[model samples]
Target: MKKQRANDSGWRGSPEVWFQAAIEILLESGVDAVKISTLAKRLNISRTSFYWFFADREELLSALVDAWKDKNTGSIITQSEAYADSLAEATLNVFDCWLDDTLFDSRFEFAIRSWSLQSREIQSEVKQADAIRLESLSRMFSRFGFSDLQADVHARTIYLVQIGYISMQTKESLADRMIRIPDYVKTFTGEYPKQNELERFYYRHGYKNNASS
Candidate 1:
């Protein structure tokens, strides 16, 4: 597999190769097998070559967290086009994409979450990612008529469910989660989701305009 290029369809030899290999190692053998030496062997490269891409294993892990964050959060914020007709649907598409085979890769998600438990740095990254996610989700809630407190509380539940699901690494299907998010959201807001402005906004852009405020 080659690194994707602006116009090319395959790998161009970059950190992603190692990152995916790391995920594979973690999934096939467990997080314990994702070390630099293991990754080198898995990738048929020298351990010293890892330094060319990352300073060390911790740095590589940091890069992995960044990749995960980009996959989960960054795309929604930067990609979805701002449009009137399908705005909400486009915004919330990130959650929907979580169901995709390439993106949803549950084993990798579970491994990342599991690794985060033992590494303070990883946990910190996860927390930061969650904070951004919650703020984004809260906006969608409020945009759909929920108040600040209500939106925040609802967002918290959603965050917990996602993390808890990863923690449990449930064998359930994405269809189940998609069906269940509405039920989960209804817990605090007392309203079910519809393909309205809010859902459109979330599908198009799942993000808080201002996290600092």
Candidate 2:
């Protein structure tokens, strides 16, 4: 047998590379399909390389959970904390996750939620994440002058809507979603966003009006 190189695909058999491959497999074929041999074959590297990073399959699975926590939950909280002049802007910042994948991986969210069905540990983690997200959103609303009760309610509404979208695997074109954002902002915040705020958001996310289309 030919000796396989460690640095195939310029990845150097890094833990992140393994985690990324595992996540891809998890998304495509569920958690059970994320076996070590499958990943080594998929990456075109030796299975031994995996041992250097992870002790076993369980370790890789734990890394997956941590990655999802850090990437999806952590990113959204950071976005929520970003400076915004108004509640509308803060809401828009949260909305960016729905419009963008780099900040929030809806697929990952769905995968973990599915995984949670099979394991109590994952279920507890998901529950904690949900609470943290809800708290962050509620604080955003409170900062915008909503009463504590109102903020919590609004936060739950937004969180549930987003979760529903992910759970149902809803799909909408970027333009269609873009058109509805203003209405969503208005409904969520009880005020339409300012023109400049809307413009800045569009520019930041590269949304085009495409009037002719």
Candidate 3:
């Protein structure tokens, strides 16, 4: 039998490796930088190896968008639906996404929004995500006894404010943001979080000190 080189012996990188490398490039540069050759170079593998994982650059890009939908949009829907004893507590659940990167990837959201400017398909996706997210928030508010109009208005207020934060690239320390959570919950839900509610929220985020209004 002839000797086979490691590269020819199925040394292609895994799908996750290519997908993550693509995301890194997308985040670091922009959508334009996410190319098969670029990713292959970054992974230090044969260009052909990419084909084993993705059909083309477009497929990989689509996967990235899907990931954004799952992580960013999905997180809000999940958090909005989480069980809470009061509207204030429910609002805090949604706020967890803003504070925790694991629940929501703000950098990925920013990159996708930037990519939307170049692709009408992605722009439509972003718009649809906004609608879906807003609807979920509205439902969350309605569950707490808000009228339809009130729910819609409050939903927009919360969603738009968070989007504004991501779009503006606002930076605030965790402690500073923590101190404002109770007021934010009150402002959004028209009900201040109880002391116990605030304590639970702080505990969930591993904050040692309770936030004060």
- Writing each residue's lDDT as its tens digit, candidate 3 over 130-201 gives 999999999999998899999999999999999999999999987888888878887888889999888888
Residues 99-178, model 2: lDDT tens digits: 77888999999999999999999999999999999998998888878899999999998899999999999999878888
Candidate 1: stretches off by over 4 Å: 1-14, 75-94, 101-105, 173-189, 192-213
Model 1 earns a TM-score of: 0.66
Question: On a 0 to 100 scale, what is the lDDT of residue 212 in model 3?
Answer: 47
**Cα lDDT tens digits for candidate 1, 1-213:** 223446532332357777888877777876678798888777777776666566678776666676678776654343332232332343345355455544455556677767888888777876787788778777766666678998788778655766676677666754445445555535645655453544443343333323222
Backbone clashes in model 3, listed as residue pairs: none
For each candidate, give its TM-score against the true structure: 0.66, 0.90, 0.93
What is the lDDT, from 0 to 100, of the residue 108 in candidate 3?
94
Using TM-score as the measure, which candidate wins? 3
Worst 10 residues of 2 by lDDT: 1-10
- Residue pairs clashing in model 2 are none
For residue 186, model 1's alpha carbon misses the true position, in angstroms, by 5.0
